[model samples]
Target: MSATTPSKLEKMLKAGHQAVTSECGPPRGSDAEAIKEKARMIKDHVDAINITDNQTSVTRLCSLAACIHLKLAGLDPILQMVTRDRNRIAIQSDILGAASFDIHNILCLSGDHQSFGDCAAGQNVHDLDSMQLIQTVRHMRDEGKFLGGEDIKRPPSMFVGAAANPFADPYEIRVPRLAKKVAAGVEFIQTQCIFNLDKFERWMGEARDRGLLEKVYILAGLTPLKSAGMAKYMKNRVPGMDVPDEVVARIAGVPKEKQAEEGIKMCIEAIQRLKEVPGVAGFHVMAIEWEEKVPEIVEGGGLYPRPKLD
Candidate 1:
């Protein structure tokens, strides 16, 4: 359906009751024009847009503010929240603020460690981890109580999301950790960028057996590699990320001019295979500066809009 359809956010989430979702990264500066352009490009194509909270630990326009802008533009946005700079007080306040703006979706995260970002010297305040943040949001909504036990006049309606890394070392550990988050009340989960579908399928199978899949929405993350160098950088330097050798070879075999096309092809293949997995809810595309290529990937995945059901 077109974005002009009424109650787009509600409609999108309901569709994803067993559907797919994707995310876009906002630019790093205050150029509202750039953000608006990016939003307009993907708004109709995706079930929801996720505004990153200082992604890669670089300072940028606030996720809450960006989400508000997307809402005004008639797109559903999932505000990505990181606890790096805010105390619980500030985090709770932002939740209430977003609710007041009628923005209800959120992705709770602890953010990157200080050492990983450009500002290593900055103090890191991990006042709450992702799981704790999910519980906190649920508490606020269910009890109408703030963190301090004070009653809120009217608690904000929120759909809580969290991240999971299936590629982490020791599948044994990662699988159970996902269960912990599900137990903590996360309503949805966007996974780390997946390059190895077999491994992801194994993880998903285990998730289903453990009963985690039944409790939350799972959106597989796919980031298109820009070049062989990027593939290597992600494999070697990016912590908590893994790219398989076959994928690297595919990018390496490609001519420099064709690298982006090869990358998109690889992403489409991943999304297709992920769709076949029983517990998979959708895919979340993190295109970084290549946000414009998202439409191609979405179409390539054979996920373009179908006729709206009555």
Candidate 2:
């Protein structure tokens, strides 16, 4: 069989671009079947699938290896790179390795601190934060030089992405920090799951006022809460996450059996509202275990798969 081309990911990022993307969580063991099942479910609904890098500091299969498998399975994969495990050398090597497989999309993240995760015995190796990692990729791609000042036979082509948290404390501090990432050569940004559109709009307005939105693609993140307890847990425990009081109340008001439906409705509403915002490039749905509902949410938002281009 012939290898599939990444026209979908490329077109979504390059076409007069209104894009929609989502993520896939890696399974606990060497079970490729679970990842394949989720990929098969949402493959037609999104432009690309992001394989997270040891998300929440939990041990899982390698994201890069998973991404390669997803690519081989005919899905566009964005290999999310976190600095929690690798230094600049390993990061650059992964970028090169990803390029060899024709997987070029990347998201740079600082990742969760080791203290927050179950792996208490695991040693942390955050040699570079998100911004520096993005800059390193930019240097490798644009300057054609690796961190060691070594030349490459062929420079990698990457669509660099970074993460932002609009809900971080001191809104004043959060906004400028995003500007710094954009200045550091981030090509796109996927925000943390947003439950408060009003606050997110305020932040986006501020970003536009600062002229940051004009420089890169910004995909608003949305994750459906599985239940009221999940909502509460995300609000109370998930660092850098902000679930608004009204959202919590909405979840609380739902009958115990109806919370998932209510959450999906709310997520659809969030995506619709985000589409109206001036600078939004797309939506990044972090559905977690609720990946099956992504198609429903996307259809609910009035977006459908664009016909494949010839």
Candidate 3:
């Protein structure tokens, strides 16, 4: 659904400026204050904030609730909805709920498997995969109809986005997969957190060759390493994660107390280099739960003093 109210994200990208966005993981417990606290940390620095829906399959406060919290705090929020937890009915209900509040930016995902999260016994509900979910949102918005061909009144005006993984296997399929998302009507793409620039550059080149550079806005994901141990964990433990060996060594070489500082430096470096990539549209700096570090990353990357949009 298109937001009747202006979206800073859509405006920034359309105006040809690189947009900056970040993710905020909602608290597992019922804590409205937690969401507000995180909002205060990065509200001034990012064009929009993405509130994750049960990320990593772990149960948390629903993304819609968190988005409302951010919106009430005067922040633009991207409501991240995963198909794993909800069926088409719940999804559409959430879309309507978010839109009524003018929370239009939504990121659709298939979600991490429940097995990986707190509820291993819980069954998944992937009634619509990521691609289908994207199409569903687009359908509801553009056609003014539900998935069942029923008309919808005042359909939410959503700025649609989907995730991409340049670091995923069978690199040949990465660009093709992205093309599918674009064809499904995604307006923006926030790629997997990138630590391997060479591989990301190659992916960008392929995306450009496919002429997708103009089809959608691409936001490269950058996460600061809070510690060398975290780097090593992401390198070895996280699926689809591609932390270069040298990067691990670089952070590991630093003293334990200073590794976080080094990680921020690395993130800023990634943003600078990505700016030169032809298809890059912006940066999605995911500082994880460490939201306080975002301002420094935005500032260090020379994205400070965010645009004063109306």
Candidate 4:
């Protein structure tokens, strides 16, 4: 369905233009100024700034508040709603509240398991999983009804997006998952940081073959490695993250001081290559904490001078 909100991200995708999105984590403390600073740093580089929700199951300034900061900073904010923390009623209410703030783009996620976070004892609120959250958002926006089936006097007009990991194991399930998200009414997808292009490409090829490409926008995910240590951590420690040995070696082969530069170069190359892929609608650059390098990567990928939609 066409987006019912004023979203440049949606406008670009619907216009068949490549989108460049990036991430910004809300500080654990009440640091609204920090949020605005990060926004100004990468504001011109991305189509939308994704404000993560208690990412990794850790508590932080809430995503909704951070999105308000982003909007005030003159940047488009994508509010991430994870079902791991809130039940259906709260999620729907937050969606309405977000729309009231003129925040329209929403990315739904099941979020990381609580075990990995600092608060392991937190309740596992799976009242609505990511899939169900997507359906709920669509229902509220398209049907003008809340998840509880109550009519919304003025439903939110939101541009919906979701996340995926083409590199995740049980690899065959990737494309099928993509299909399911599209069927559930996700307008775009942001995949996990990709280091294994072969696996990602194969997944894309299968998705293309299945004709899913035409139905939804797929933004290939990219994250520049800060060091050999970071690469190793992602490969061996992060769940469902696929970082190839060659990637680790390449970063390690470089001098410790230069590893960051090497990682950035690798990210640039991936962006360039994915631009030619059949199903890639754009790129979602998850720069980790390295927001300073987003513009360099976007420019290096030849996506600078972000498109202006009338």
Candidate 5:
């Protein structure tokens, strides 16, 4: 979309500043107060809070509702939409709904498979993949038209974003895939959690060679290894996540009581190293359920005092 008045996240990226974004998940039950409490803790520490839409295929409160709650609470939220849950009709309708509540930033994703979530028998409705989803949002925002050629008088003014995995298999095609997303009109990208910096940098080099960095903002994904068990879970069970052996050893070397501290230290180091990478714009720090630790990590990583927008 041609942004008329940029969202805070868009303004920071366009200013060439190192932006910081974090995730805030909705609760399983209808406890809006709990969600608001979590957002209040880190609202000042991040450029925008990402409202996840039933992430990992687990059912939760709708992302649009949570985003509107966050918006009313005075926090800028990026409404995340997954293709697995809704068809294009619902997707576009929710996009308009989110905009009506003043939510401007959106991240389109092909969500996690249902088999991994609590319900294995749940049938997914991936009516549109990430590419088509990106195009759909652009049409609504820029063209002011629905997918079926209908027109909107005042369409949603949104800054579109998508997720990427530099560590995924057949690594040779990863950068080109990213180029394809950029070609599809994604204004920004947030990668899967990065533990293998060498591989991530290599992917960044490839993206730089293709000039994808110039076309879109790239926010390196980061998550601290909370424990040795957590590391093993990511390495063995999680898809599109690459936790290096050295990282495992670093966490394992610490005592059980101190593992979390060591993990945060490693995250801080990763942020410092990524700052020097050519195509890296900023970090999307996802502490998962450990939301309270975000402020410490952001301040420790030296990304605090997020750019002020006029």
Candidate 6:
């Protein structure tokens, strides 16, 4: 709970205000302008922007580097660290490096399997799972010591986070899984894109029952379906993602030229509804490649002009 310097997103949540966060995947190449353009588009509209760590296991500019770029560009960045690509040494080293850049918000992820990325034959080095990664960072921050127990001259203080998927299979187990993350010292959780509100609410209900909601912030994930094809793709292709049939049907009902508009409208409506759900702290909008639409969606969801940090 104590950070050497709290991130903008941490400050917003601590102020007891509803917060809005978004994600920005780093480009495949080292194009700072491409990163800056995307960051600038959504900076004013969100409390923090998540720099994905080679999202989908594909090669990309390092998330920590991209985060520093965003910080330099006047935006708060959440540096996502995945375990699939790094061993404990590299992970911890990167955490220290990221902190040096004033990137204080960290999201620990297990990452997508290599099969999904360009490196199907690549070797994975999940020396630690997501839960262990959370614990590792928390230990480094709170104890000011590395996993090897050497004292750190200066610890990396951070607002720690982890992802969740309420719609994933064995649905009943999701709540307990989240509880474990909390126990591992996750301060907040951003879930996978949700189309099944009923399911998300139920997940929240379970979280509430277990008193997990009170322990950490919960930011529900949502990605506006840009087209019926996108909807179908998520429902069929994306693992651990659940796009309800009704959502697909609604998008399908819309005319081809207007589907994008309809998709945004759907997201707005979902935001309005989720705001009223108990234990729902805020939202994490993952617009994917449609970064430009973030401003509209945030404004439409009535979360613009993110609360000022005191």
- Cα lDDT tens digits, model 6, 1-310, are 3334568788888778788999999999988888889989998889999999999989999999999999888788999999999999999999999888878899999999999999999999999999999999999999999999999977997899999999988877899999989999999999999899999998999899999988989999999988999999999999988888999999999899999999999999999999999888899999989999999999999887777775
Superposed by TM-score, candidate 3 places the C-alpha of residue 232 at a distance from the truth, in angstroms, of: 0.9
lDDT of 6 at 251: 98
What's the CA error at residue 105 for candidate 4, in Å?
Answer: 0.6
Candidate 2: tens digits of C-alpha lDDT, residues 1-310: 1112343555565564667889998998998888888888888888888998889888899998899899899788888999999987799999999988888788999898877767978888889999999999888888889988989778777778899999999778778998899889988789999987899999999999999987877889999888899999988988888888888899989899999999999898888888999989888999998789989998898777644544
Better of 2 and 5 by TM-score: 5
Residues 124-222, candidate 5, lDDT per residue (tens digit)? 998999999999999898899999999986799888999999999888889989989998999999999999999999999989988899889899999
Q: What is the lDDT of residue 108 in candidate 6?
A: 96
Worst 10 residues of 5 by lDDT: 1-10
User: Which pairs of residues clash in candidate 4, taking residues 3 or more apart in a chain or in different chains?
Assistant: none
Residue pairs with colliding backbones in model 3 are 1-156, 1-157, 1-158, 2-157, 2-158
Greater-lDDT candidate between 4 and 5? 4
What is candidate 1's lDDT per residue for 1-310, written digit by digit as tens?
2322233443554565434456656667777777778888876668778888888787778888888888888767888999888899999999999888878788899998877667878999988878889999989987899989999987878778899999988778888999999889887789999987888899999999999887877888999999999999999998888899989999999999999889999999888878889988778888878888888888888777722534
Query: Each prediction's TM-score against the native?
Result: 0.93, 0.95, 0.97, 0.98, 0.97, 0.98
Candidate 3: worst 10 consecutive residues by lDDT?
1-10
What is candidate 4's TM-score against the reference? 0.98
Which TM-score value belongs to model 1? Answer: 0.93
Model 4 Cα shift for residue 20 (angstroms)? 0.5
Q: List the residue pairs that clash in candidate 1.
A: 20-282
Q: Between which residue pairs do clashes occur in model 6?
A: none
Candidate 6 runs further than 4 Å off: 1-5
Once fitted onto the true fold, the runs of candidate 4 whose alpha carbons sit more than 4 angstroms away are: 1-3
For each candidate in turn, give its C-alpha RMSD to the true structure in angstroms: 3.2, 3.3, 1.7, 1.1, 1.4, 1.2
